[model samples]
Target: MKYEKAQEILPQDLINKIQEFMDGGYLYIPKAETNKRSWGDSTGIKKELNNRNNNIYKDFESGMKVDELSNKYYLVENSIRRILREHKKSNK
Candidate 1:
């Protein structure tokens, strides 16, 4: 999200009313529900995590130890285990 000058875009009356209520403040305007994206939709983080988890599964199938995977992926052992468990559950 970017800060846009309300004075430049909004009607003068609306801006005046807003200024009357709060001077020199931030106003949060949310997108319409129809325009909203789900989490990670715009950033590609979801795709990246999926790719990492798939690689984790492949590494485990190739006999990678949990601790080794944790070290290689920079994740904790428990996180690696959880990823493996999630993969298993999803496969079923």
Candidate 2:
């Protein structure tokens, strides 16, 4: 989200109308419903995580210790265990 000046884009009358209720503050305008995207749709974070999780699962299958995976991935031991569980569950 970038801050756009009303004076730069909006007409003076519209700006005045908005100012009647709000003197000077930030206003958030959301995208249209049809234009909305699911979480991680625009960014590749979800895809990256899926790939990483797959790698972790593969490493675990290849005899990597959970603690070693935790250290390599910088995740908690429990989190690595949970990821392994999730992968196993999904594979089934």
Q: Local error of candidate 1 at 66, Å? A: 0.7
lDDT of 2 at 47: 92
Model 1 regions more than 4 Å off: 17-24
- Best candidate according to TM-score: 1
Model 1 agreement with the true structure over 1-92: per-residue lDDT tens digits: 78999988999999989999998999999999999999998999999999999999999999999999999999999999999999999999
- Residue 86 local lDDT, model 2: 96
Show how many residue pairs clash in every candidate, following the order shown: 0, 0
Per-candidate Cα lDDT values, in order, are: 0.96, 0.95
Clashing pairs in 1: none
| Location of the lowest summed lDDT over 10 successive residues in candidate 2 | 37-46
Superposed Cα deviation of residue 71, candidate 1 (Å): 2.1
